[model samples]
Target chain A: MTSSTTLRQESVRETRAPVEVRGLHRAYGARQVIRGLDLRVQAGEFLCLLGPSGCGKTTLLRTLAGLDAADAGEVDVPTQVAIVFQEPRLLPWKRVDFNVRFGVAGTRGARAQALAALEEVGLADHADAWPGTLSGGQAQRVALARALVREPHLLLLDEPFAALDALTRIRMQALVRELVDRHRPATVLVTHDVEEAILLGDRVLVMAEGRIVRDSDTTGITRDAADAVALDVLRRDLLRELGVGG
Target chain B: MPFLLLLAWQLLASGGAIDERLFSSPAHTAHALWMLTTNGTLASNVLVSLRRSAIGLLLGVSTAVALATVSGLWRLGEELVDSTIQMVRTVPVFALTSVFVVWFGLGELSKELLIAMACFFPVYLNVHGGIRNVDRRLVEMAVAMGKGRRQIIRHVVLPGAMPQTLVGLRYSLSISVLALVVAETLNTTSGLGYLMANAQQYLDTDVIFACVVVYCLMGITADLVVRVLEWRTLAWRTGVGNR
Candidate 1:
C-alpha cells in the first residue's frame, strides 16, 4: 500500500513545468485585467479557478494558453497546450472531423486520431457534418475533441460548459473529469460555479480583482470519495471568496 | 405563369388588340430569331459579345481582388486605396460612357474598358468588406491552437472570407451584363446591341424583339452560372435559400 501511494504521488508530481506562471500582468488599454499573478499545476493535477465575472480568471487563462502574451511574467509551459474557450469557436466552414484534425501532430495518422478523439467525446457520427448543423452541446463536444486531439501536456478550459443546460452541463463535467484523468494533462478550468470547481479540481483557487484570494487543497475530497461536510466547507469558502452569500 | 404571359400576348396580337407594327407577335419574333440564327448573324454577334464580356469580367475581377487584398489586409492600403474607390464608385458608371468614348475612342477598347470599370465596384467593395468581417473568433481560436501565420491565413482567413466574396462575384456578373449593353451602344459594329440598332433603323420590330429575348436569356444564364458556382463552392452552407 505504501509503495502504491508513493508511485501515485510520483505520477502526479511536477515533471517539467507543464504550466508554471508567475507575475502575469495583463491590461486591456487603460484598465488592468490581470495583475501580478502566480500559479502552478502539477503533471496530472486538475486545478479549478473560481471567480466572479470580470475578475480576470479568463485573462489569466488566456495568458497561460498563449493566446495573449503576458505583459510581465514567467510562463513556462509545454508547446503542446490545448485550450477550449467559453464558446465552441469551431470553424463554420469545416466539418467536425476536420476541426478535430486541425493542428494535431503527425499528418499521417491525424485522421484516425481525430476519429478516436471524436469517439471519446461521443461525436464520432458527426465527423462529416458541418459545424453549423450540430446542436450547441454537440458543437461543444466537438470542441472538446479538438482540444484532446493534440494529446497536450497542458490543457486549459475557460468555462467550456458554461453555455450548456443543466443536464448537459453535468454530463460534460463527468466526461471532462474522466478524460482529464486519462490524458493526465496539467489542467486549469476557470469557471464561476463553485460546485463545479470542488467536484472536478484536485486544487481550487478563488480569484478576486486579478489575484488569487483563496487557494484550497481539495485532494482529500475528490468526487469519488467526496465527504459531504468537507465538500460543503470548501464550497462555502469559495463562494465567500467570490463575494457571494455562502 | 411565363407560358401564360406568352399565350396572352399571342391572343392580344392575333385579335389586333395590340399593334403588330409596334409589339411584334411571339411567333413572328421566334421566326425572326430563327432567321438571324440560320443566317449566322446571331452566331457571329454573340461570339463577339461573349469575347468582350469574358475579357472585361476577367480583368475586372482580377483587379478587384488585387485591390481588395491590399486594402483589406493593411490599414495603410485602406486609407489610400479604399477611399479613392469609394469616391469613384458612386458616379453611375453608365454615365461615364461618353467620357470613356472620348478617352479611349469609340472602339472595342472603350467598350471593354467601360464594362470592366462597371464591374470593379461590386467585387471590390464586397470582397473588402468580406475580408474585414472575417470572424475574429476563428482567427483567435487558430492562434490559441498554435497555428502559425501562414496556416492561419490558409485555413481561417481565406475560407472565412469566401461566402461574401462569392456574393461579390454574383453582383459583378449582373453588373457586367448591364455594363455590356451600355458599352456596346458606343458605336461598335458587332453584338446584340448592334443587331438592335440596325433593326431600329428600319423599324424591324420582330428582329428588335428577338434581340430583347436574347438579352433576357443572357441575364438568366448569368444568374444560373453564379448559382451553380455557389452550389459547388459553398456546399457547407445550409441555411435559408440553400434548398
Candidate 2:
C-alpha cells in the first residue's frame, strides 16, 4: 500500500507546471483593485495571497480563475484551472454527488470521479445530502472537493474557509495541506488570516493597496507555531502601511 | 375574530336584530345549500366552473412560462414581446371578455380565453423577474465550472427562479378562478355564476348566498392545492413551512 501510494504521489508531482503572472491590473469603476501586480507559482507550490480586507486578494484570485476579466496585464494560465469561492456556491437543487460532478462531462465515469473526490475530503457519506443541509465547514469541504475533482493545473481559492469556526478552520487548513501534498496542483489561496497563510502556503505573498508588499517562504514550519510569528510581522508591517501605527 | 363576527351575524339574524329579507340567516343559507345539493344543480355548476378554470389556468401558466423564459433569456425576443404584453395586460379582463365572446361566442371557449388572459400577467411578470434577478455570483460560478448556457439554465436559473415562479403560479390560480366567475356572470349558460345570476333575478337570496359560499370554498381549495405543490417543488428551501 505504501509503495503504491508513493508511486501515485510521484505521478501527480510530475503533472503540474509553473504558473506565471506579469503586471496584472484590475479595476472596478473608479476604484483600482489590483494595480500592476506581478507574481509566479512554481510547479507543485502552494502560494497564498495574504492581505487585509479590500486589498484585492480576491480580485486577483478571480482573475486567475478566468471568472473576472483583468483590466490590464497578461496572465498566461493552463487550461486546467479550478476555483473555490468563499461561499460553497453549490447548487441547492443538486445532490452532493451531482454538485461535485457539476462542470465535469456528464457521464458514468464523472459520477465515479465525484465520489472519489468526496471520499478524499472525508465526505463520502454525504454524497446524497443537499447543500442546504450542510454545516459551513462541510459545505466548504465540498467546495474544495469540487475544485480537486477537476484535477486542475492551477487551483485558485478565494478565502474558502473564512466562514468556518476556529476549530474547523484549523482542521480544514490541515486537510488542505494534505490534499495539496497529494495532488500537487500549483495553488494560489487568497486570505486575510496571516496564520492561515503561513500554515498552508509554501510561499506567502502579502498584498497592500492591491500590490505585493512582502514575499517569504515557510516551507518546514507548521501552521500552529508559525501563526504568532507571521501574524506579529504582518500586523506591524500592515499597520505601518495603513499609517495606523508608526 | 372573523369567526366571532360571523357568529354575531348569525345571532343578529336569529334574534331579528336585522331584517331577514335583506340578509338571510346562516341557517337559511345552509338549508339552501342542502336544497341545491339535493337537486344536483350546485354540483353540476361547480364542476363546469372548475373545469373551465382548471383548463384556462393550465394553458395560461404553460404559455406564460414558455414566453417568459424565451423573453427573459433572449434580448431580442424580450424586446419583441415585452411591449406587446405590457400593453395587453393593461386592458381589463372585462374589456377583453367582450372581444373573446365576439370571436369565440358565448360558450366555454370565450370564458376559458378570458380566464387565461386574466392569469397571464402575474405569472409572466413573476417568472421574468425571477429569471432577471438570479444571483450573478452563482452564474459566475457555474460558468467558471464550464457549464454551457443550457446547463446553466437547467441547473442554476430554473432552481433559483422556482420559488418566485411558484408565487406567481399561486397568484395566477386565484385570478383564473375570479375571471371564470366574472366571465360566467357576463355570458355563460352554465356555472356557479349563472346560478347566482338566476337566483338574483328572482330575489332568491338563499341560493345566491350558497353560490357565494361555494366560490369561497373553491378559492380556498385552489390555494391549498398550490401550497401542496409549493412544498413539493421547494423541498430544499429552508424555513419554507414557516414562510
Candidate 3:
C-alpha cells in the first residue's frame, strides 16, 4: 500500500504541466491564424498572452481549450479544462444557479455544489435569479464561478474582463488571481491590455503576426500600480515589442 | 367604441338607409346567436369544430417541430428537406381544397388534412430559422464544457429557438382557424360553417353574422392561449413588458 501511494504521488507530480504544444498551426481557408507555435503551462502558473487584435491570441486560446482543431503539429491538454470568454455566455433561459450547474453532473448534491460556487462569487443571494436580470459584472462573476466549479486542470480566459468598466475590471482581476491561486490551475489568459498581463501573470508573452516575439518574467516585479518604476519599465518593454509608442 | 359601432349599425338598419335583408343589424345577429344557443346548435357545432382543430393542430405542429429539429441540427437533413418545404410553401395551401376533396372523398379526413397543411409551413419555417440563428459562441461554450450533442440540443438549441417558435405558433393558430372555416364549408354535417350555409339558403344574414362572430372569438381565444403559454415558459425573458 505504501509503495502504491508513493507511485501515485510521483505520477501526479510528473503530470504537473497540463498543457504542451509544439509547432501548432491553424488556418482559415487561405489565411493562417496560428502558425508554428510552441508553449507549455506548468501547474499553478498564470501565463498571460498579450497581442494585437489579429495576432492569433484568440485562435491559440481556442485551440488550447479544444474548441477548435489545429491544422498541424502536436497539441496535448489535460482532459479537464474550462474556459471563460469575453462574453459571459450564460444561457438566457436558465436561472443563475442552473447555468452554473451546466457542466456538473446531475447526481446527488449537484444543486448544493452549484450554490456553493455562486457563494464563492458573492452571488449566493442570486442563485434563483434569471441570468438576464443580473448586472454585467454579476453575470461575468457567475461565468467565473461556472468555470471554477469544474475544478479544471487548465483554465483558459479570452479577454474576459475586456467588456467591464475599469473599476469592475480591477475587482475581477483580483478575483481571478485569488481563485487561480486557491484552485492551482494552469491558467492562460489572452488579453490585449499589457498592464493586465503584467499584473496578473507570472510570465508574459508578446505576440506579433501569429508568432511570439518576446517572453518576459515578472516574478520579482510588484503588481501594484503605485510601483511606477517597475511597472513603467515593463510597460515600455511590452509596448516596444508590440510596435506601439509609449 | 364597440357599443357605439353597434348603435350606429342598428340605427342605420332600422332607418332603412341600408337594406336589412342584405346586412343584418347587431341586434338581429344577437337574436340569432341566442336562438342558436337555446336550440343547442351552437354548442354542438363549436364542440365539433374544436375537436377537429385540436386534432389537426396536434398533427401539424408536432410534425413541423420534429422536421425543424432534424433539419436544424444536421446539414444533410436541411439539404434534403428545406428546399421541398420552400417549394410547397409557395403553392397556396388553401387552394388545395378541391384536390383534397377528390383524394379523400369529402370526409373529415379532407378537412382535417387541410387544416394540418395550413398550420405546418409557418411553424416549420420559423422554427428552422430560429434554430439556425442560435448564437455560435454559446454552442462553442457548451462544446468546450464537454457537453454531448444531445445535451447541447436539449439544453441550448431548443430553448434558444423557443421565442421565435412561439411567434410561429401564434401565426399558425390564426391560419389554422381560417383554414378550418374554409374546410368546414365543404359537406360539413355539423359545424358553424354548415349552420351558416344552411341559413344562406333562406337569406338569413343574421345567422351568417353570428357565425362570423364565433370565428372571431375562436381566433382571439387561440391567440390568448398562446400568449399565456409564452408568459409561462419564457419567464426568463425580460424585454417586451416582461419586467
Candidate 4:
C-alpha cells in the first residue's frame, strides 16, 4: 500500500506541469491575439508576465484558465485553476461569505472554509454583509478570499490591483506575495507594471505582440542588499523593453 | 395627500359645485358601498374580478418568466421566441378585445385571455432585460470557478436578474389591473364593471363612485404587495439603489 501511494505521488510529480503551452495560437476574427506563444510554469513557481495593453497578456491568462478557448495550441493546464480579475466580480446579491464560497460544494464544509479564508483576509466580521456595502478594497479582498478558498493548483491574476489606490495596491501586493509563498500554488500574474513584476516574480517575462521577448531570472534579487543594484538595472531594462522611460 | 384630495372632492360634491348627476358626495358613495357590501353585491363582484385577475396574472406571469428564462439562457430560445414576442408586443394588446369577443363568445375565457395578454409584456420584457444585463464578468468568474451551466443560472443568473425582474413585476401588476378593468367590460353580468354599468342607467352616481373607489384600492393594494416582496427578497441589495 505504501509503495503504491509513493508510486502515485512520484508519477504525479513526474507528469504534470502546473501550466504548459506550446505553439499556442488564438485569434479574434481577422486579428490574432496570441501568436505561437510557448511557455511552461512549474509547480510552486511564480511567473509574472509584463506586457503593454492589447499585447495578449490577458488573452494568454484567460486561455490558460480555460475561460476562453484557444484557436489552436498544445496547452496543458491544471483543471484546478482560479482567477482574480481587475474587477472584484462578486455577485451583488450575495453576501461576502457566500461570494467567497461561490462555487464550492458541500454547504457546511464550504462555509467553514470560506469563513477561514475571510479571516485570513481580515474580513471575518463581514461574513453576512452585502457585497454592495463593501468598499473597493474590501470587495477585492473578498475576491481574493474567494480564489484562495478553492486551494487551486494554478492561480491567475489579471491586474487584480490595477483599480486600487497606491497604498491599497501596495498592501494587496504584499498580501498576494505572502499568500503565494505560503500556499505555493503555481501563479501567473499579468501586469503592465514593471516594478510590480520585479517585486513579485520568481521569473519575469516581457512580451510584445503576443510572443515573449525578454525572459529573465530574478529569483536572487528580492530584498537583498547584494542584489539591489541588479534589481534596479533589471527594472530599467524591463521598462525600456515595455517602451517606457526608466 | 389622497385623504386631502378626497376631502376636497367631498366638499365640491356636497356643496353642489358639480352636477349631482355626474358627481356623488364621498359620504353618499360610502353609504352605497356599505349597502352594496351588506347585500353581498360588492362582495360577489369583487370576488369574481379578483379570481379572474389572479388566475390571469398567474398564467401570464409564469409563462413570461419561463419563456424569458429559456430565451435569456439560450441563443436558440432567443432566436425562436424573442423576435415573435417583440413583434406581438408592439400591437396594443387591449385593442384585441373585439377579436377575442368574436372568437371566445364574450365568456370568461375571452376576459381572462385579455387580462393575461396585458400582464405578459412588461414581465417578459423586464425579466429578459434583467437577465441579459447581468454582468458578464460575474458569469466569467463563475465559469472560472468551475460551476456548471445550471449552477451558473441558479447562483449568478437568477439573483443577478432579480431586481429587474421585480421591477417588471410591478409594471405588470399595474398593467394587469388596467387590463382587468377593460376585460370586465366584455359580456359582463358579474364584476365591478357590471355594477357600474347597471348604475349608469339609473344615474346612480354613488354606486359608480363606490366601484371606482374599490378599483383604486385594489390597484394600490397590489402595488403594496409587490413593494413588500421587493423589500423581503432584496434585503442584500441595500447599499446600492436598484440598478
- Which of the numbered candidates is closest to the native, going by highest DockQ? 4
lDDT of 4 by residue, A1-246 (tens): 112111011125433356778778878888888888999999999999999889999999988788777777677877667899999999888889889988475445588899999998889999998888888998999999999998878899999999999999999999999998988889999998888998899999998898999999888897463787898899999989999895
Per-residue CA lDDT of model 3 for A205-235, tens digit only, reads 9887778888888867855447678878989
Model 4 ranges with Cα > 4 A deviation: A1-16, A105-108, B241-243
B1-243 in candidate 3: lDDT tens per residue?
988988999999999998989999989999999999999999999888988888888789989999998898899999888888888889998788999999988778888888998999889999999999999889988998889888899889999999999999999899889988999988889888889889898999999999999999999999999999999999888532454
Ranking by DockQ: 4, 3, 1, 2
| DockQ score, prediction 2 | 0.36
Summarize candidate 2's per-residue lDDT along B37-128 as a digit string, tens digits: 99999899999999999889888888999999988888997999877898888878777777888899877888888888888888998998
TM-scores for every predicted model? 0.93, 0.86, 0.94, 0.94
TM-score of 4: 0.94
lDDT of 4 by residue, B149-239 (tens): 8889998999889999999999888887888889987679999888888998899999999999999998999999999999988988755
Q: State the DockQ of every prediction.
A: 0.44, 0.36, 0.55, 0.62
Scoring only the A-chain of each prediction against the true A-chain gives TM-scores of 0.89, 0.85, 0.90, 0.91
Ranking by lDDT: 4, 3, 1, 2
Task: Return whichever of 2 and 3 wins on lDDT.
Answer: 3
Q: What order do candidates take by TM-score, descending?
A: 3, 4, 1, 2
Q: Give a tens-digit lDDT track for model 1, residues A209-242.
A: 9999888889897655748888777777777777
